[model samples]
Target: MALRTRAVLVHRRTELDELLDRHATRGQAEFFLRTRGRTLADVEARHEAATSARSAVAASVPSDWALAEVERTDLDRFLFAPEDVVLVVGQDGLVANVAKYLDRQLVVGVDPEPGTNLGVLVRHDVGDVAEIIGSLAAPRAGAGEGPFSAVRCDELTMVSARLDDGQELRAVNELFLGHPSHQSARYVLGADGGAERQSSSGLIVSTGTGATGWCASIAHDRGGRRLPGPTDRALAWFVREAWPSPVTGVTMTEGVLGRGGELVVTAQSDRLVVFGDGMEADRLEVSWGQEVRVGVAERRLRLL
Candidate 1:
């Protein structure tokens, strides 16, 4: 039997959707916004644009192809198959949100508004989606071309943190090891060169994909560091505000992790946690005496 071709459309909640959720009605939301000198007009327009883009992409799917829609909040619960083609429709962050859950599936990022080039991930317009879908649905598999063979893509490196207990977490951007409440965290940080007991707010290990975010900020604050490119098999890490005391030192603050290299953190506090791409709700809890190793993952994002 031929392999089943599937398309999974991923999206996030719009500002208007959040407003309605909080205020319970458009009238109330409008009233509250009006007091702040803002109208619902802009929010409604963006919401309509996002919805239109999602609908258009959905309509482009071939009737013979199976289709599924996943909201950002449901990514963890959604089960993705190997043959799924992921079309992330939203800002660039939406792409990062879904990247951790995928396993070599081709991704097509759709910009809902499409005017500005703010996104490195969301590169295509809504009109471009139809052609991509058509290309995927064409009868070309017998000629040694797969469903998504016509499109071009780049494989981006990702970061993974494996705990001593065997649990693991991955991120397309960066991984954060810290306390849940942003309080000072205590850990023993180790690398190939050396190790140190640190007391600080937390630590961050960033991929080149994540350098655009917190990693870039940290680099800027520290007079810049040579960050790896998106396709580079490397990672960068930093310890945030490490404290110096009689028992702890602030020597190991930052470094670049090459391919096959690892950064190890042994938790010394009860509430130490690890999260990726700002998704603190989905996190790994490491207790005292537990160790987590950070490294470049073997799996890469196949982005179209």
Candidate 2:
């Protein structure tokens, strides 16, 4: 039997949804914001735009394709197949959230409010979704000139952290290894085989796709260190606020990691966290005596 093509629409809850979840009622939510010198109009407008964009995407999906909808919060529970084509309809962060769950799946990012959101990753406007999907669904004819050529995508690199316990996690942009409370975290960090013990706020392992976000900020603060481009296969690692003390050192603070190379970190704290793309709530906890190896992931994001 032939494999079925599934279309997965990944989305995150809107700001208004969060406010209402907290306040129970729209009026109450407005009142709570008003007390803080804020207005509900902005949040409501964003919610409306998100709703309109999602509805348009739903209508555009063809009937023949098997459809599945997964929220960002529920991504861990969703099972994605290799034949799936994922569509992220929201901010650029949503694309990052969904990328790790996919393997060889094509992703289409739709900006809900293009005028306000900078959407560096979510580059396609809502109107461009249909054409993009059509191109993806069409059969490829030749090399670069085909109607369905995969060249219409921006192939982005990603990072993966595998624990010694056999559990693994992938990041579209970067992976943060640090204390869950952002306190000083103690650990031994190593690249390839050389190692050192260090105390720092945390360690950031970033991919070329993540060079623009947290990694870029760290580089900017450190006299503007050079960073990799979005498609570069090499990864960059930075130790945030590495404190030099009697037992801690900052010698292995920052560097680029290419293929066949790896960054190893051993846990020294009672509890450490490894989260990706700024989603702290979704993370992996590393306790004492555990080791994590971070490197370029085998999978890549094919952004159309």
Candidate 3:
């Protein structure tokens, strides 16, 4: 059978949706917010705008294309197809949330509320989806043009961490390896030709795409370190608050993992967490004496 283009509309639960679910009714939700010195009208207005944007993007999908709507909570259960053209319709973080679950599918980010977000990832508006879909569906190799020349795309690098037991995780932003609580985490960070035992909060292994997020902030606070670009085949890692002591050293705190380089963390604490893009529920657990490897993944988010 010929592959059909599936337009997956990815969204999250709006604040109003959450309030209604928690408070059971709009009046009750309004009353609850009012008690907290916040007005429900503002929430409703934002909700209406988001709902309208989602509806507009949904209507923009090609009529012949198969349509699938997946909430942020249901992404783990949703089966994505190879020919799928994703329409990420939400905040920029939504793009990172969906990237790990995808492969080479062309992702068109539809920013619902413009000017509010940094526009680092979701670069298109609701009006641009129909045209992006048309461009994606149109023929390639026009005259001297190459594949996908009709559509502009960025091949963004991602970070992947693998444990010894065959479990693996990928993230477009960064991979956080830490203790469940905010307590001290014990581990040995191995990267850039050396290894050292350190006791600290945890480690954040990020990519060029993630550089603009958490890693960038860390870089700025630490007097700024160069990070890889979005298309660069590299990954950067930072050891948070590494303490200098008799047994632990802080010199191996932060570094970049070039091409084939990797970050190997040997667990010394009871249990260390490894999650990507803030999805802690769905994550890898590393116990004492176990090893986890973090590096640039072979899969890249082909974002449009």
Candidate 4:
């Protein structure tokens, strides 16, 4: 049997209609309408381009497209088939809205960021994402069994050390430790079995994903001279050798603690900030010897 194909056009109403006129067949294509910003002129401009393109294509093929604005509740109905292709226009925001309602279906994000929309959408919708291109394969099936599974949080320990129980954790491109007070904060950087006492305005750890974010731009001014850790040294070399790094996302899995004793985290004179995935959480303070733990999570984000 031939593969059954369904096309979903997500664009401005005018543009959607034009695309339908050119690429859609009576029984094959459907339109889902979405508008951007507040201005109608932007919508009209997109419509004109779409209509013009459709007019050009219509001369050679029979267009049998059906068009309509996609309703939020009906999104599941449209995505019911695994073979369905969703063609989205506008920015990542629009695509994000559509993805919330879709699951377990093949989604082809058309004209997405760079050459692939798959990675962009996946980063926003799920966590601990690494993009795979070209070939399609079923994701390995297991619970917390992948390369990053060891450090992933399987269960939150109730015993309070530095991090609190029920504190959710996730890894993004970077790990952010910020303060609102505009005064430098003290931190102790450490890895497995290794530790260092350092003072800074704030600290950040950047992953490959967040090599270009704020974590990369902020200067580490404290003169605690020691050979950089593998990742830190590499990032330093990158800054010296390559383009300025960009911030991606912050670490959300670990806990922030106060400096002196075993306190989850308390507000001192200076406000403590911990931000990840472009979102901010409660602010607190850290004293001289506070510890922070950051690591990957156990669960993988599955894309349909």
Best by lDDT: 1
Worst 10 residues of 4 by lDDT: 235-244
Global lDDT scores for all candidate models: 0.90, 0.85, 0.87, 0.34
Please provide, for model 4 over 24-141, each residue's C-alpha lDDT reduced to its tens digit, 9 standing for 90 to 100.
Answer: 7423223222232244344456556544433332221213322233533354355433433344443433443454333323333333223333344332211111121111222323
Candidate 4 vs. true structure, TM-score? 0.36
TM-scores of all models?
0.95, 0.92, 0.93, 0.36
Choose the strongest candidate by TM-score: 1
User: Which digits, one per residue and each the tens of the lDDT, describe model 3 over residues 1-304?
Assistant: 5456788999999999999999899999999999999999999898988899889888887787889999999998999987788889888899999999997777888878765653878898887777877777665433222234345689999999999999999999999999989578988888877899999989989898899888999999888999899899998888889888898888888888887889889999999999999999889999999999999899989898
In angstroms, give how far residue 186 of model 2 lies from its true place: 1.3
lDDT score for candidate 1 against the true structure: 0.90
* Clashes per model (N, Cα, C within 3 A): 0, 0, 0, 16
Model 3 spans > 4 angstroms off: 140-151
Error of 1 at 36 (Å): 1.9
Candidate 1 residue spans exceeding 4 A from truth: 140-151
